[model samples]
Target: MDQQMFCFQCEQTAGCAGCTGKKGVCGKSEKTARLQDELTGALIGLARATNGGTLYTDDTWKIFIEGLFTTVTNVNFHDDTIRELMGRVHEDKEKLAPMCSGCGAPCGKTGDYDLSRLWHADEDIRSLKSLILFGIRGMAAYAYHAMVLGYTDEELNRFFCKALFAVGEDWSMEELLPIVMEVGKYNLACMELLDQANTETFGAPVPTEVPLTVEKGPFIVISGHDLLDLKLLLEQTEGKGINVYTHGEMLPAHGYPELKKYPHLKGNFGTAWQNQKKEFAGIPAPVLFTTNCLMPPAGSYADRVFTTEVVSYPEIVHIGSDKDFTPVIEKALALGGYTEDQPFAGINGGRTVTTGFGHDAVLGLADRIVEAVKAGDIRHFFLVGGCDGARPGRNYYTEFVKQTPEDAVVLTLACGKYRFNDLDLGTIGGLPRLMDIGQCNDAFSAIKIATALADAFGCGVNELPLSMVLSWYEQKAVCILLTLLYLGITDIRLGPTLPAFISPNVLSYLVEHYHIAPVSTPEEDLKALLHEGE
Candidate 1:
């Protein structure tokens, strides 16, 4: 059969390989996937046109970032919206290079790149370029979040253009490899930029306990990673008697002082993005998706689904540029939340989950942590974090965290924590055994905490008793992995499946240099990670 679509940029792609059938594992139809590719191609074309002498302005950078973000898994599934984005990209390109449109023999220098070439290229080249492309796609998400908060880096903007331009070039492995690594370098910068934007804008997050109960009356469940949306929703719903509970990535918003100050911003609503289908189905409140990880809504809750920013679905109400969440508010009020307080619990049966151990919060406890380690009260540290999904083997993360030794501490971030965030691991010294380190972008905080611990002990980060067992589902996790590699952190175990985009040659190189390994059984991997038999 002829290939209808090809996508492997996500972990749960069909069967550990590319999704090339009529629909993707994430519910993206073949039509939507094709438009996403075209949208990507158009962005590359714009990059090419801009490289031909037109400098990247704020407008250009915004379009480029949004275009890339739109193609990320579960971001935008509407073909019309994707086509609209392609139109905007093409319009920007035409404006930048007006003469190219009219030229008769246009040499194909500034035309939209045909992605099939890259898709069908030699495996190693495809692998290296895929790293660059997907890495920047992930980084664009951070950049987009930062941009919304008025944070823009010239260097970061320029890198997007440079990387997009390289994707269209027929570069060799030697030529593309540096750009691949550079994606990691710049993703670190992007994550840092987002960290600053979030902390500075929302106040440094403090350790905060969030309940799982849905308070009586009208309520809104905001999901995805946009804190700005949550803030606005809180503001609009303040006097309206509607409560706002975070779902998925937005759960960490409770740790921010500015966000937490809102009395109506009650608690977290669901476990993880993967559970949204089941959890949101019967909820009495509307769910607003502000970014990716938006699974197509099941028919039960389809009407209650609203999208904003780059997240779009056909026929779903989209809160547009004005950021007016009025429709979402009205939907919440109309739904009329649970009549009485409805209690919910996380996957591990705890009624509350704690978040906000950002760099500042963790580093504030540096002295106590260092002393505990020195006194041998803390035997090891495990950074078990990343995206979560519905795939079967994902239970590995829950089991891995479950099997952790008592003297060890587990630092988790992102939606992956839903696996076991509610488990009562008790305390180590004066701190909780399991620490929630904010969102995926807060991987910077994890890096800071690890590096600080290593610095206090006078050893490299790798030499510290730190191991990262991550579960990845999408592009954001890809860039975070690159950042970890960029920092020279090694012995990382990534699962539930190795990326389908990673070619054997590239995988071997990562194994040889970074010691990156696919996650095996929780028992066996834990034994190896702890050096039990070595």
Candidate 2:
């Protein structure tokens, strides 16, 4: 098939539809896109092989995760690596159901389903399945991280197979829509598992003030959300004359006791993932990615980009299972960073950013928050957070955070906060008006803090004076959205624009039932979200 790829799996898809040229808006090339599709098809076969009565081994679960997680928007971009994963999926399926391969009378029951069939399916059915597929890709990232630390859920793994098998089936909108929601339901459990794993392995996060200044001398920038990898790199580089800095989602590593112990773990670098193309240009340090949200590198700094775990780019050096970051350390040493300290600031020009306010930190002040509400000192709460993209309209978050009531608290996480996290929002009721939660998966922490507040106030979550203004860009945001909807949370404001994959009927269903609305201007949305119940 001589075809340009068609992938609309992210918010940055071309023309709000699919990427239909040599490269996607995210910089994924045509060859890489096709490999991702082939990988998805093989995963479908592996899922089908686990049907009705097949024995699902531990290896099967790991391969299942690698297969689904690799196709995420920016996780992997190497054709060889993707095809290698596809081969593993098929090998696993053949091992489980031997008759399905190379038999004189082979069965069609466990054959790979062509992913093109999905792209060509009816619009409504395709939308529903896309939710299931993209949502799982995001969930798999969280699951993979948890698994690295010895956390796994049987139900979660089983649901992975069920969802993938549903993707391959000739299911109608009625059948697939619920499975789509089920992806959200299971993703909540998945996130909870990862949270437990992270907090247990690294200790609970605490409030820590991290500077934005890059110190003189050699340093390495570690991006992505694998705390274990960060910990290893920090330990490996300690006393080795190379400083380390967290970038993007890895910024929260500073809060963990195990990670914060390292003195060389110096402040953060760059803003959100979308800014990497410019931020990493001609940088004299090496950047390592440990999870999702990887934009392809430019020729100027491509040599300095190193991918570990499942993240890959065509010719980039990949630190494989060994996790020996000698290559990255050597690169950093060779770059010989800035001769003098280089001062950096967020988009707001704030010289420093703060994080580590996980659930324990926030809920510790639950009584005070309740009292402030009763005393009318803190009037409302806004969870203005999600992924950030290069799209033109994402400035709504910046303006919304800027225009929030002085007495309200703005809780944020993920890269979306890079837009406004640097702004000085001051304090309300002895707590900073703006609080930075951990990674996107740390939305579990936000949910926990919200439930605690509602419990303290003797009210349901919706009845509390809280509003969510989220900006979504990828599959992780999708699963998080689904989890919110499944919990019966109502009246969410999602923008810069709604998902293109969501059909009109499906979106209307969400609107009528959940009261979901596209965000308007900050002034308009703020007034409605703040004063509507009153």
Candidate 3:
């Protein structure tokens, strides 16, 4: 059968093989997916042109990051946006390799790569390149968020181009393995830049209990990764009888003292990212998306979906370069919400979920945690979090959390926690059983916490009594998984299905070297984790 188009970059491909037909599971059309591949191929050519040269500049890095971020699942859903970005990539490539323009003698070099070659390459090579490509796509989300906060790092930017360049080159495992680890290393730097930008700009997040109740009145719901957008929305709606609620990843913003101070900044709205379509249906107020994990808007509530930052949905109101957010404010007032305060609750029936227990909060209690571990009061630490999705097997995360030993501590981050975060697991020692570690980008916090524990125990991170059971649905999780692998953090249990892009050989390599395993039944996996801890 002839392939319709290529899209195997996410957890839900068209047929578990790849998105070869007209549209992907995420609703990405074949035409748009092909353009994404072209944009990526152009980036690779630009990276190749910079080989062994110092010609790389900040502009080069920005284009590379933007290009990668655009390819992530649910970020850029418009064909026009992908086409526009491809034009920009081509323009940048021309500037980098002017010699390739009219040379009759083929250099075999600077021209844009035909992505079909990658689609048809050896499975192993294609898998490694896919890793490099997808890993950067995830890292680019963090980089884009950090950049929005006026923070930038040179090494992180440069490594992006280097990684993209390697994706185009003919490289084997011996050569690509180091580059793979480098992706993790640089992703750490990218994540740190974002963390510093967020903390420095908003202050260290403290534990915050976000309510689920929506007070009757004019209110705006802000989703995505852009704090600045949320800030602007709060400012625009201030004293205007309009309330603001955080949704999805934006729920963590409630932890920041600066944001939480807004009297009208009410509570969180929904559960995981996957539920946005159904949850947002008939939502009275406007919903602003600041970043990724944006599902295709359901027609029932498409009018209420407003996009800011890089999140674009066709026909939706877009708060552009000015960041005014006036349209969103107007939408809130027009909707006028419910007549009275409407009480809502999380999936677990809890009225609220506590978030913003970042690294600073957790590490402050390090002494108590270490003591609990030493006394065998806390038998295991499970980092049970990642991107959540609608997949059937995704119940593994909720089940995993449920089956965790009462003596163990659960550290979670990202939108994935919406599955079971509302359950009151109580506390082990002085630490809460379920600790929320900021946003998805704050996986840096989990990494920091893990490293700190390893340091205190005088052993490597893998040697510590921590196990990472991750669930991935998008590219950002790919970068984070790469970062974990880069840190030599082993024995990670990843699911609901290994990325379709990963070939059998590459999967075996990860299994053999990193002891990475797929998730089985929660009960079975819990037993294996406990055995490993012993």
Candidate 4:
């Protein structure tokens, strides 16, 4: 049977194949997904054209970033938005390829390649293209975040084009392998740009313990990836009886000095992005999503959902380009919160978790960490973190952290830490055994800390006593995964589900060369890891 249309660039696809026929698991339709692919293909063609010595303007980079961001998980659920973006990409491609106008000789070199060719290619090629596509999709989110803060890097912009064009080329493993690394190399720059933009604009995040309790009276909850939206919410709601609480990826905001200064900015209200449905239900507060990871709103909480920036869902209130958050504020006041301070604990029953331990925070304590390691007090370090989702097997993270030896320190970041952050793992060498290193974008911090540790010990990153056991739910995780691969850091354990988009052959290649394994039962995997340590 002929497959319908698709846009399966996510971990969760229909039937573990791809999103075919009508609607995706996240409610994106076949036509919209195909249009998104078309947009990506056109961006790739523009990238190829630019690589042929044609200079691309800053606007070109903006279009490239926006196009990629639109296709990320749960970002744009509307077909009209996808179609509009596809048109914009087509217009940009025309502007870049203007001279190829009506050349009768069929110059295939200049026109946009159909994305279906990639979808139908050999498994290896498809996997590599998927890597490039997914990598850029992830990078775009970070770039968008940076751009909103008025920080943009030209080299990072150029690499987006370079990497996208490579996906369309007939490259093999020998040729594509370095480009895969280049994705990581460029992502480091992208992440650095975002890190600088965020830290400079918001000030460095300090160690802060945020409560999960919802205080009495009116309060607003902000979710998704955009800090600007959160800031605006804080600004608009300032001194207004309404309070603001972080949700999903926004939890890291509590660590930022500028954001934490908001007297009305309360604490985090829930765990991870996947738990929004149950968590937000009857919460009596409006939730604003500034970027991706927005599921289709259940009818019960449908009216409370407000979206801004690039995130959109049909019929939800949208805070537009002007960035006015009046609607969200009003919703919060209307749904007045509990009569008393309603205390909420984390999944593990802890009142709070320490965050803001980014690379700077950890590297500042490098001497202590090194001394502890040399003294044999800290035997190993495990980076057990990544995105969290609703998949059944995700308990492996909780078990993985639970099973870590007392001599090992567990460093985590992003929403994945919610799985085990609340677990009161005692201190090692006077440092907390469980360190929350801010948001998923802060994976750059983990990379920096690992590199510095290796430099301190005069060894390669893989030679150090660090291990990465990551869980992925979306494209941001995809880019970070690629970053690790690019650094030649091997022996990664990825779970709870291998991406349905990765083909068998591609999976085999990663397994054989990179030693990337899937999560087994935590007991078995922990024993194997301990055996390796011995």
Query: Model 1 clash tally?
Result: 0
Clash pairs, candidate 3, are none
Q: Indicate the worst ten consecutive residues by lDDT in candidate 4.
A: 100-109
Q: Once superposed on the true structure, which residue ranges of model 4 sit more than 4 Å away at CA?
A: 49-53, 99-105, 109-111, 532-534
Please provide TM-scores, in order, for all candidate models, with all chains considered together: 0.98, 0.97, 0.96, 0.95
After superposition, the stretches of candidate 2 with alpha carbons farther than 4 Å from their true spots are 1-4, 52-54, 103-110, 532-534
RMSD per candidate (Å) reads 1.3, 1.6, 1.8, 2.0
Model 2, 30-91: lDDT tens per residue?
Answer: 88898888888888878878883256765999998878888888898888888888888877
lDDT of 3 at 38: 82
- lDDT, candidate 1, 425-491, per-residue tens: 9998878999999789788888888988888999999999888899998998989898888889888
lDDT of 4 by residue, 1-534 (tens): 146576666666766567777787777777767777777777777777676425666478888898899889889887776777767766766676667645544545467778888888887778777888898889999999999899998778878877887888888877877787788888888898899888888887787888888999998888887887888888888888998888888888888888888889888888888888898897988999988789889999999999888887778888889988888888888889778998898898999877888888888899999999999999999999998877678888998899899999999988989988889899887988988888888888889999999999999998998888999878888889888888888999998878877878778888998999998888888777766656
lDDT of 3 by residue, 131-221 (tens): 8888988999999888878898877877887887777777887888788888888999989999899999998899988889999888888
Candidate 4, number of clashes: 0
Q: For model 4, what is the C-alpha lDDT against the true structure? A: 0.84
Q: All models: lDDT?
A: 0.90, 0.89, 0.85, 0.84
